[model samples]
Target: MRGLLPQLVMRVLAAGLLTVVVAAGWVLWDTARAARRDAQTTAALVSDAIAARPSFEGLAFGGVAPTPVFRDWQQFPAWSLIAPGICVELGPRDQPIQRRCGPYLAAATPPDWFVWLANRLGLVPEPVAVPVRTRYVSDAYVTAIADPGVIVTRAWARTGDLMRVAVGMAIGGAVLTGLLMIRLLAPFGLLLRGIEHLQRGDFTGRLPRLRVAEFDRLSSAVNDTAAALQEAQAARAELTRRLFSVQENERRALARELHDEFGQCLTATRAMAAAIAQSGESTAQDGARIAEISGQMMDSLRAELARLRPPDLDDLGLRPALERMVANWRARMPSVRFELGLAGPIDAVPDDLALSLYRIAQECVTNAIRHGTPTHIALHIEVGDAITLTAADDGSPRHGGTIDSGYGLLGIRERVDALGGSFVLAPVENGMRAVARLPL
Candidate 1:
């Protein structure tokens, strides 16, 4: 949109310039034509006046001397002024006549190119020849040459001045058009920048009101969109935070119930079994079997409680909890290698952030083992201004697969988004990589 303005402006300017040039050419041509017609009429009137002069009629009839008439013709005031370029003389019909040429009709002749152009346009008038009517002669005639250079030169000067004015107007129109375009598009620039901010997740940016009606409508629409996005994002963050809180609370409650009620029941059953086996009627073999079964039940219950919620997370902090979890996975899957890289002060991290990171890492490792059939898994956690967790497995990529809500990746995404963080899960060259970043 920004790039199109200059092109539009240039086209308008070119059109305006073309219009002015055409108008100037037309005006010059018309004025030159009119001047040519007027100069021809003026020359005709001068010729009629010369033919009516008695001195000229007497010279043509041979009743008067040519010397006196020629002298008088040159000195005549009206003829000298009106038809200075006209010449009058007497000669035999068989002889060539030579007359003294008068001054040019125009005070100053125009340039050669201008005169040529005027001639091409048919502005130059033909000479007017009028016969002097007399009783004695029929062949003698007075010739009047109408020179239109004076009129054409003056018209050309006027046309030149008008052309200059037209050019100035064209330039001024272009300048005004440019300024108007800049003013109209000013609001568009602001709107574009605001949209860029929104794309970067900075929804707080707003577009200012514009004077143009269409631009104002666009500005209002953009502002509304930004506000809606900001509101929706805030609501989603709050909802995610509440949901995670409730889920953690539920896990803790379930773990407590398993430990307090179920664990106590298992212990009481084991004691009763041992007491019965100790009776005189019970064999030593039966007592050993009963004791072994009760011990296995208690061990299974403890493992179930740990799976629900790890007590080490609260007591030993995040690092030790993760190390224990990884050790357990290594024990379960002896064939697969597990690597952990922890950096920064993990102990100083807030409980909620540490839990979110831990849960995400645990889910990634579980997915790698269950689905990816990975030979090696790498888990890395770095804490600073932000906490970054990355997990990768060197196994077959999980191609064309989706994770259900029960798979735990959904929960990790919610937790990360709640903290205004980013989560990415993509296939690597050898397997899959999961990355989560949470702000400190």
Candidate 2:
């Protein structure tokens, strides 16, 4: 049980941790993606700002008379270099005359990411021939003047550095959250231990309040379950004691009935037979009367012996006992055809089990003969781990009813149930079926 608890806890904890990890990781990844998107958008705006400048737009090396150099420069004067590490430049491919519009020197080339962005924005034709290295570039933008000039700019570098810092914080937060979950779940182990102790018949331990409301409720439920189980055990023990007491009393009464009633009747019959034999008569009529009286006494004696302890049960076990019972029923009701199929041997059964099974069968047959008023009755018995006795017949039920709680059937049910067995009475396809299955 102790070994089992940790496995259960691990299963629960793993499920909870997986849920948290999936949710938190999704949020972190989405935030990172959104940050990268925002960085790119900012870079594009800065590049466009630098590109729309008059002097930077296809300006020749010496022809600068069309637009003033310093008048409209303030409107878009390399604001792409507004932040640290940002740079922008406009260079002509014809004469290699580069105008430094932004913060960095014109000799510097923009990062590869900026060149790719420039091509995607249609500032240059497909497949720009610039050789550039691959690296993490948060945001950069570039523009080209069809083959005459190319402008490149850096923007949102500060946003890139901020994103890196945010990623670090997100990872640290995830670790800290996982640690907190572990701490919160630690008390669950205590609750589990408390349940284990209760299962091992130790109910003294009380779990300390975890301060978590949910855990507190769980602890209360565990304590209640332990209390309920203890109460049920006590009640069951008391009921068993009462049932045993009743059984003992019944056994004592049966013993007394056999010894007092049957014993006295047999003793008187034996004495009467001896006296009649000693006082023999010579007349043939008197001899015949004496023989008849003796025969009646013997038959009565046999019936008394059978009542005290059924001789058929001892002689042929359950099968012959049921057969004799069926024969007796047939003799009593000449109109009824009683069929008996004692299917299997029942010799190995204990005394109590045999008695319970025989009583159930006798009661069911008696009920059928009394109330069913059937033309035919069938009795079937088989013994295995349990004794199954069934009495089915083509007869109508009593009380103008198809179903009722008759005394005999009720007694059979009570007896079978007392011995941890099953009793069933239902209408079969042809007639009613009475069944008692008692454990051997």
- In order, the Cα lDDT scores of the candidates are 0.74, 0.57
**Per-residue lDDT of model 2, residues 1-440, tens digit only:** 45444454555556555655555445444533443443344345544454454343324656554432322424553444332222222222233223233333333354677456545543322211121111212122242222202222322232344445665555555566556667878777989898998977665567776799999999988888777876765665457446644764565567567657766765666566556656665554554556567567667756655544566886677667767877777786899898877656666777666766776777777777667668888888888767788888888644322233534766576566566567778776657888788776
> Ten-residue segment with the worst summed lDDT in candidate 2?
127-136
lDDT per residue (tens digit) for residues 200-244 in model 1: 888888888788899899889989999999999999999888888
C-alpha RMSD between model 1 and the true structure:
7.1
Q: Which parts of model 1 are misplaced by more than 4 Å?
A: 1-4, 47-51, 54-165, 168-187, 206-225, 252-308, 332-336, 366-376, 392-403, 406-410, 424-434
Cα displacement (Å) at residue 418, model 1: 0.8
Using lDDT, give the best candidate's number.
Answer: 1
lDDT of 1: 0.74
Model 2 bad stretches (over 4 Å):
1-308, 397-407
Candidate 1's TM-score reads: 0.64
